[model samples]
Target: MAMPFFNNMLALLGAIGFWPSVVYFPVEMTIARLNIKKRSLKWLGLESLNFICFLLTLASASAAVRQITQALGQYKPFMYKA
Candidate 1:
């Protein structure tokens, strides 16, 4: 019964929890702690990393949604297909 809501909600929750925790906060803290100058090479690199991580998270979430949709079509609650 809950399977329909499980994967997407899990992905949504994970992205909500992990995006800021893993990506934004750490990068912001690093910039503040080290005082990386704006527009400098190091700052650009860190920002690039931040953007990449964001892209990855977006990709993962989209993949989860896609998989959920695919499985939902093939699935029936409390039934076995294989």
Candidate 2:
């Protein structure tokens, strides 16, 4: 009973964690591009670094949810001997 609930909760968490990057990355890149004065290599490097960090965070959250779900699925309830 609780297993399904936990799986659903994990799925929801993963979705929540993933969506912001999907929506924010393009907007962030656009803003960064627009604000750059001269398109220097330094500014491009910083933007790429920021995007990489965001990708790492999103990947970590997704992997965590996957691991937790798999762990939960393997759990067995202990039965008492009468």
* Candidate with best TM-score: 1
Candidate 1 C-alpha lDDT tens digits along 1-82: 6575586768867866677799989999999999999999999999999999888888887877787788778877887555
Model 2 pairs in collision: none
CA error at residue 25 for candidate 2, angstroms:
14
lDDT of every predicted structure (CA atoms) = 0.83, 0.63
Query: lDDT by residue for model 2 over 23-42, one digit each (tens)?
Result: 45664676577786445776
Please, what is the TM-score per model?
Answer: 0.76, 0.46
Runs off by more than 4 Å, candidate 1: 1-12
What root-mean-square deviation over C-alphas does model 2 reach?
5.2
TM-score of 1: 0.76
* Model 2 spans with C-alpha error above 4 angstroms: 1-38, 77-82
